[model samples]
Target: MVFDVVCIGHLAKDRIVRGSEEYEAPGGACYYGSFVLRALGLRVAVVTRLAREDLPLFEELDSIGVSLFPVQVPETSGIENIHPDPDSDRRICRPRGFAGGFRAEDLPPGIEARLFYLGPIMPGEVPLDFLRHVASLGPVALDVQGILRRLRDGELVIAPREDQGEYLKLATYLKADDVEAKALSGVSSLEDAAPLIAAQGPREVVLTHREGVLVLADGEFHRFPFKPRSLAGRTGRGDTCFSAYLGRRLLGDPPREAARFAAALTTLKLERPGPFRGSLEEVTRLLASP
Candidate 1:
């Protein structure tokens, strides 16, 4: 069946540490983003690689009506996120396990979507050639961080993409946090970087930062401030924003409107853990408020 969005990436088993508390949770761009899309009532499918032992972690997705096509591998890509403060987006990232890269053949035959979201959690996880093939299938909403993030000396580092133009050209909508945007364009600010990234080819660029989200589309720039009560669920902020924004876009909201809706929706997600559980009415209410 054709889906609204097909999320392609590794399903991660993340080890999250906040002060004295620590726990293992399902993460990765695909893991968090697909959940948000599905929760928004979009028809979502996930294509990911993970070990059989870790397959149980996907039960939440299955229960939520998300169609998951998981490829069993020797390992599941993962990371250990060290949060010094429980309410901070800042964290120390360490490489844990890597399932490996995806190939074109890994995509199920005849599966299709109106939007393809590349959610790779590490550089090279979704090979360039594979991404090119997905672009042929539909408009791509990409999380640029995965392709630009690398494991260096056991720490997570950003490596500027030498062929940023190629990837940007293939994507219809692109997402990056301020750090990733700076690394990609060598610009200190998102205002400067968003336009540069958009020029490469994505019609829309979603640049998220501490204060809020910046959306650049059709030569116009829009900013939406986030008002989360707390940052308890900061880990998936980027994933949540990108998925919710694209979901709203596909549902017929304009660029600026979509960005606002995403910011409000993500604000609620940040107050809790896992995917967003708030009702659509709640988000609509938040969007309508001053």
Candidate 2:
């Protein structure tokens, strides 16, 4: 079945530490992205693998609004070591290789979308040929951090983009934080990072600096400032921001409005402690004129 938006990636049980006992949640771009879109009033679907033991979470997702593009794999899980700091948060992500990714041949017989979001499990995890096919299907939006992020002594580190530059052009939108923005663009400041990332590929680029967020689209640049929340206990804010941006766009909001709405949504998520804790009401309230 065709979907308004489909996010394909790995979903794993995340053990995040912030306040007291370690907390657990299903974590991954596909999980967070589809959840946010469903909350935003969209028909969203997710294609991911879950171990037999973790099947209940997927069932919970289905009971909500998200449809499943299931991929069965016996060994499927991701482990994350998160150390949340006010200024710097470190996450060591390990995809057990249990999920081999959904191959192009396995895609729905003839399914298509106005939007396709691919958050790679690792560098080149989706394969260049598959990326080309997905981009050809429709406008593509990518969270490029997965391509550049690697585990360094169980701490998240970024490797310079050596060969995946070609895939960036396949994306209609590129979303990354100020650091990933610098890594992708080789620029120092967020202001400089915008043009550099836009020139790399994608018609639009959004850089989420700690202070605020910036959007470069249609030969113009726009920024939405926020009262930066103290989210010293969670991860996945970047993924949350991108999904909201696309959710608003697909719902007929203009680019500026989309960016504004996303900024507010992200701020709400920041206040919460986990990836998907913030609800539709909190985000909507944040978006209201203040």
Candidate 3:
């Protein structure tokens, strides 16, 4: 079957800790991104790996009309995010469990998509060869976090990959948060990092910072700020922003407009503690406002 996007990643069982309070939730870029794409009225399919017992976590995606191609592995991937301060955006993430990696055989045969989004949660989840295979099928929008993130002793560390340029060259679009971008490009500013990252091969680059989202497309830069009333849902900020931007671009919106719409959509998402549940009309209304 043909789909607007085929998202490949590990479905995470994330444990979020804010001081003494803690909760487990289903997460990962695929989990958050698929919801944003579907909410934008796009036909979406997810190719994910998780434990058999955790299969029920995908029911939420199924209920929303998202097609699932789940690969049951030995364990479900997860992370324990410890937020030290309630008022700060700083958090320390540690490895919980890893579901293993993806191979070409894991993909459903005869599947086709306009875009393939690779959002692996940790190193080796989606290998380079698998990324090459997916890019051969169509455009790839890659979230580079998984590629750069490594498990060190027990902590999750974001470091630069030696073969990063190789992976970047295969992606049609690339998504990186401020930290990842800095790690990848050695440039501190997102505005400077975007074009340098784009030069590696991606035609467009999307960089998300604490304040806003930025897109560098066609040699021009576009930016939009996040005006959330609160940052309760900051966990999936980059995932939501990247997916929303791609959805709008797929619908033929220019980079500037797509960036604006994505920013507004993500702002709403930040106000809530889950995948985006806001309507397009709500985004439109937010866009219309000052």
Clashes of each: 0, 0, 0
Model 2: per-residue Cα lDDT over 1-290, one tens digit each: 77889887777677666545466777777777776788887888776765666778667678767877766777665655555443555445554444665578746667777799887555445777887888888899988777787767755576667765787889998888777887887877887888877887889887776666788989788798755557653466778788988998899988899998888887777666655556778767767757
Write down the RMSD of all candidates, one decimal each: 1.1, 2.4, 0.9
Sorting all predicted structures by lDDT, with the top scorer first, yields 3, 1, 2
Alpha-carbon deviation at 158 in model 3, angstroms: 0.6
- Report the lDDT tens digits of candidate 1 across residue range 1-290: 79999999888989989878898888988888877788778999999999999888889888989999988889888889899988777898998989889988889999999999998787779788888999998899888888889778988888787887788789999999999999878898899999888888899999998778999988999899889898878888889998999998999999999999899988888888776777888998988898
Best by TM-score: 3
**What TM-score, computed on C-alpha atoms, does each candidate reach?**
0.97, 0.89, 0.98
lDDT (CA) per prediction: 0.88, 0.74, 0.91
Q: Which lDDT tens digits does candidate 3 get at residues 1-290?
A: 99999999998999988777789999999999999999878999999888899998779999999999988888999988888886577888898899888999999999999999999888888888989988899999999989999888888989998899999999999999999999889999888899889989999999998899999999999989999998888788899999999999999999999999999999999998879988889998999998
Q: Candidate 3: where are CA atoms >4 Å away?
A: none
RMSD of 1: 1.1
